[model samples]
Target: MRGETRTVWPAARRVAGGLALLGAATVGYGVYERDAYTLTRREVPILAPGAAPLRLLHLSDLHVTPGQTRKFDWLGELGRLVPDLVAMTGDVLSHQDSSAPLRRALAPLYAFPGVFIPGNNDYYVPKPRSPHHYFKRHPGGPHKGPALDWDGFAKDLVADSGWRDMTHVHDVLTIGGRRLDVRGVDDARSRRDRVALVAGPPEPGADVVLGLSHTPEPRVLDAFTADGVQLTLSGHTHGGQIRLPFVGALVTNCGLDPSRARGLSRWSAAGPDGAQRMSWLHVSAGLGTSPYAPIRLGCRPEATLLTLVPAR
Candidate 1:
């Protein structure tokens, strides 16, 4: 009996040590993936025949801190692209001091015309919560935290940077010498999106129409589809934040399905006649994670450069 006990104890220790090593390695790798900033290039078919392609840069979920030099550097590098338009589907801040870093990171891109809408994180600071609650009871509307200075940021964003703060607004602007219709609302996950106010078909004869939201809730997408929006850009899922090999995204953290957590997918609203009105939807995996839960697995942080082409 004594000899058998000794053997079991030795084997148990070895197994426990192996598990500890694996856990440490997993955490280290997750951190590495979080920092792996990447850019995804895709083509958006949403223009008239013979119309020139408009390069659009979609940015989201910045969640910037006071001095994240690495992220800011990457953002600065993107200025070289000189895209025709930029869309900032928000969550642009995670810390009280994030505004400065956020401004520095995006200053380069501001040179181009852009549109923006706020995300939940933009208004409230991210707070740590029980892991299970991340899926079961993730926050919405507002939670306990210090407020971010979004007003100051928004004011300067329009007056100084020339970017349009498109929250809850519908209007037309000229881009690429063509009329582009844009409509966007406040963060939908927080129940702030008042889509009905601006709900309608694209401005008559507008060359292109686009919608923006921080969260890709199904109802919002349906509204955009109903309105004939050519393409809609959004973020807030963080590409499920943690992905797996074949399983892909485990959770969307929003009403969106796991499969469409990131990248382009067709969206539509059901027509009364059992028809589907399809519209283009591009949900950026986004460039940063919530400051409280700063980790990534198979999912890398990202932005997307969408080149609008003529639909066949």
Candidate 2:
């Protein structure tokens, strides 16, 4: 009996030690994932014939807080990519005091032409909630946190940086010698999007027609697809922030599927003549997590550099 008991005690000790090691590793990994900044590059063949390739940098969901030097450094480094255009899909702030740091970080990219649309977080700050709640469907209710100064945010990002504000409006621009017809709406998650304002087919003779929004809400995508927009870009889901390996995002928080929470996919809708039209969609995984829940797992915070090549 003594011999048997001694053997069992040793085995139990080993098991306890292993469990403690695993727990420590998990916590360390969570910390690492939160600060891991990754850059993703994708080649999208969506340009018209005879058009030159356009290099576009897509940025979103910075969730910038004061004194986050790593994130600020990463933003400044992005300028080295020298993209033809920059598209920012909001959630650019988290704390009221973050504006100055955010602007300084983005100063390098101001040299390039860019467009921006506001997200829900841009208009209102985020409040703390249970991390587990992120995996469930978002409950619609009154927003938390104090109201943000969206006008000032826009002035710094749009006016000071010389970037275009595409909120509920359409514009035509000549980018890299190709004509682009771009239209965008405010965030649909906050019910701020007025899709009717810019709902129409692409302008004639436009080399490329693109749509931009903060959330990849289906209704807005449907409207853009119906209007013959060839491509749409957005961010807001954060690629679930804590995805699983192979399983991917747990919840998109919007109409988009979990599989497409972060990357490119095709969006289709029925036209007036009962014909189906398809458009390319790109949803950025984004750069930062909500300040309250700062840890990430399999999903690394990211910004995407997309090369737009001519389609066959």
- lDDT assessment of candidate 2: 0.88
Give the worst 10-residue stretch by lDDT in candidate 2.
135-144
Predictions in order: lDDT: 0.87, 0.88
RMSD of 2: 2.2
lDDT of 1 by residue, 144-236 (tens): 488888888888678767899999999998976889899999998888999997788789889999999899998899988887887999999
Best by lDDT: 2
Point out where model 1 deviates above 4 Å. 137-142, 271-275
lDDT of 2 at 49: 75
Error of 2 at 260 (Å): 0.5
